[model samples]
Target: MSITLTQLRAFLAVVHSGSVTAAADELIVTQSSVSAAVSGLARELGTPLLERDGRGVRPTPAGAAFAPFATDVIGLLEQGRRAAVESAENASRTLRIAAVTTSAESFVPRLMQAFATAHPGVGLTLDVGNRDRVMGLVLAHQADVAFAGRPPRDARLEARALHPNEHVLITAPDDELAARAEVAPHELAARTWLLREPGSGTRSVNEDFLAATGLAPRTLTVGSNGAIRQAARARLGVSFVSRDAVADDLATGLLAAIAVTSAPAPRAWHVLCSGVGPVRPVVATFLDFITARGG
Candidate 1:
């Protein structure tokens, strides 16, 4: 038998939720129906996709490989359905956005408010996460468009430079480094740095800047922008963060910008969308709106 959308959905739910019972709850179907769907899908593919776990289930190797395909298929089908519905009902447009944390906390609100004022009927959904998570949403087709501090490298993604993103070195107002007019690059290697997670765009940029300047400082990893800011405020360590992210703190003396002689040059914030396919009307309209406003 040919594979069916329902079967794929059921299989994906099970894989994501980790159990037939949980998948049934998510799909709003009975456990037996979910079980039957998984069985049917496995039989159609001539391989077992799942194996039992302790009191739950896990994907077999074949299932793990198929997960991306399953997510992509579901995403595409949902997009098509939304496109059709929105084409017939112009007032019911929906746009989805994924944004990096810095943008999400700073500029995204103003952008969203302006867009809503211009197109009041369009329903908007925004997902705010770190850079890696936002990129993953775009790759998974879960977001119609994304805003990020750095351009993506994947062939499936297309990006436009929106605006300049300036990263600045920050320290507690009382810290010794804050009073310097311009800290030399050689002096930077001795400072304790509060760093974000390894895969973060901010961290990557900081690393690249350090590599170019031959400065390697001791780092204490913090997961979130808020945490990093707090750490810097408490004099736990100094940090590099988006100017937009620390604007209020800088203004109020909660944090002070440390002028460094060899600081990183401004990088462009990017507007990214899938390059491999046609964008939906809502997505197109939002892209045009943002680009016109210089993002």
Candidate 2:
């Protein structure tokens, strides 16, 4: 029997949601329907695709390997549908945008507003995620454009610098370090630091800053920008975050920047588009706006 899209979707949903029951809930289908689809898919592939893990489900090695293929198939088909719709209905043009959390909170809104003002007919769909999720959306052809603090490394993608991104060490306004005129790097080593989780672009930059300054601090991993900002405000620890992300806090005396002898040079926020082909009309229009803005 041929593998059908229904089976593919069911299998992928189960793989993502980690349970047949959860997948059924998400897909609005019966549990038996999801189970049968996945089972049929496994049989057609001649291997077990999933195994139980704790109270949920987990993809086996084979299932894990097949996920990208499944995502690409779904993403490409969806892209085709959108393309056909856009062609037949010019007034319904939509641009799917994905952005890392920091940029989403900081600069993406202004850019989107300006773009919308310029092209009232085009619709925008913005997805906020961490770097990995944003990059995956772009790579899968699910996003027409993506904004990230750092450029993606995939050669299949093209990237452009949209704006500057500056990171700084921040502390509670009343912290002793905040009063110092020029704090030495060694002084920070013994203090606590609020760090982003692994695989975050912010975490990578923070690590680099620590290594470059030749200091190590006791670290606490905080998962989100808002939480980290609150932790800093509560005087729990210092943190390295984008100036853009903490601009209002800094301006209102909620957080203070430490004056250091050597600080990280400014990086950039990048606009990324995946795939190596002539640009689509909507994407090209956005890129042209980006160029004009950046220039």
Candidate 3:
């Protein structure tokens, strides 16, 4: 006979609780039911799954080996249930969004708050990652929509320009670079440059800026905007990042933006969705809100 989910669950509970009585209590069932379920599972697998130790229970080698797989199966089932519930609730009034780090850090929270206020009872999930990863999430249908500085060229996704985004050279307030209201691109290039990972939009813009001016710097690559910011704050090196990401720091004088003549003009931020068909209603509503608010 095939292994039953019920039996697996009972076995896992017993392993977790370390005693059949405790497992029964946790499962809100009788101890006999737990014992019978475990025994049945062991018989089906043709192996001894548990052993009594003094006053408690312990998994035998076979049971211990099966525990992880059983837990994973149960987890997947729970996740499937959650996804179904989320999908149904989404059909009624929920929005699932994925965004690159900058957009998520700077705009998403406010957008979510406003969206929630405007559409009460609407559920929302926002996943944040780098540009490529966020786009992938949207393309895979894991997210209904995404926001990023530039839309990807993937054929499976549809993208629309939302608003212009500016990148600024930032440095710690105490750093010598902070004294300059604006540093020429070539001069800026001479400094140690902290940068985001290669695929990030900010990094792309930074590279473009260097290429346009025919300048390269001592470069140190970091993975996230937060890391870039921290590195800059530690006075390790200057970094260029989205203005939105550093707005608060710029305002507070903890960090300063170094103007550069050759800096790329602000580029358009885009909203991306799957190319399959008409956008979902919740995603549409959010896109409308972002466009209306001038992003």
lDDT of 2: 0.87
- Which runs in model 3 stand beyond 4 Å of their true positions? 1-92
Each candidate structure's TM-score, on Cα atoms with residue i matched to residue i, is: 0.81, 0.82, 0.66
> In each prediction, how many residue pairs overlap at the backbone (N, C-alpha, C within less than 3 A)?
0, 0, 0
* Runs with alpha carbons beyond 4 Å of true place in candidate 2: 139-142, 151-158, 174-182, 197-199, 207-216, 220-227, 248-254, 261-265, 276-279
Candidate 2, residues 1-295, lDDT tens digits: the string is 6988999999989988999999999999999999999999999999999999999999999999887777667777777777778889444999999998999998889999999999999999999988888888887787999998887677757898877898988899998888889988888888788988887889888888889987788889999999999999998888889999999999999999998767778898889996644457889899999779981
Q: Write the per-residue lDDT of candidate 1 for residues 103-125, one digit (tens) a residue.
A: 99889889999999999998889
Global CA lDDT computed for model 1: 0.87
lDDT of each: 0.87, 0.87, 0.80
Q: Which candidate has the highest TM-score of all?
A: 2
Off by over 4 Å in 1: 18-22, 28-32, 47-62, 181-191, 197-200, 203-223, 260-265
User: Using alpha carbons, what is the TM-score of model 1?
Assistant: 0.81
Compared with the true structure, model 2 gives a TM-score of: 0.82
- What value does the lDDT take at residue 146 in candidate 2? 93
After TM-score superposition, the amount by which residue 130's alpha carbon in candidate 1 deviates from its true location, in angstroms, is: 1.7
Per residue, candidate 3 scores C-alpha lDDT tens digits across 134-158 of 8656654667788888776667677
lDDT accuracy of residue 284 in candidate 2? 89
